[model samples]
Target: EKTETNILKGIERMRRFAERFALAAAYPIAMEIIEALQRAAPVDKIEPAGSLRRMRDTIGDLDILVTSKKAE
Candidate 1:
């Protein structure tokens, strides 16, 4: 029970931090970034995953999956 409480407290702290600094991007911005990446690369598949994929209200960071024929 103590561990669970601690975890919950930690999550609340993180949420406050995110809110305080506005350290998250809106969905549209995330989408734009993904689109830019796709356009820049020879992408066969490009998708946003993680919190973005889950459609969170605010995204801390972007996680993109891209598949391309070009090797780099």
Candidate 2:
């Protein structure tokens, strides 16, 4: 039982670490995507939302808002 408990705890810790790493890794990619979108579209304003906006250590997904004169 003790061994099982230890293994479970280790797994949980690893999962949390992976989540944080993934988020950290995604920041650059998200920024690139946002930049590309701005360049491709006629955007006046672009802002990060959700976890990225909050500047959290870990993010599950990216949310962005864009405003453009071309948008209807």
Candidate 3:
């Protein structure tokens, strides 16, 4: 029983880790693209942070602007 619990815990941990890794790979370049799009535009309603999670009902991709506090 203890071995099964440990294995399940490890599998759950891997799932969480994989999610984070996928998001990390996607959000960096996505944010940069969103930033560039914002800079080139003349709109005032959307701010830097608001650029992400915009148009929730839109059919296309989410052009997000993500900010991280981690040190590289």
**TM-score of structure candidate 3:** 0.40
Which parts of model 2 are misplaced by more than 4 Å? 1-21
The lDDT of model 2 is: 0.84
lDDT of 3 by residue, 1-72 (tens): 999999999999777555343444545666677677567665444333332344222122344443434323
Best by TM-score: 2
Residues 1-72, model 2: lDDT tens digits: 999999999999888776454667778988998999988988998888988888887877888888888865
* Order of candidate numbers by lDDT, starting with the best: 2, 1, 3
Looking at model 2, which ten-residue stretch has the lowest summed lDDT?
16-25
Stretches off by above 4 angstroms in model 1 are 1-25
Clashes of 3: 0
TM-score of each: 0.61, 0.68, 0.40
Clashes by residue pair, model 2: none
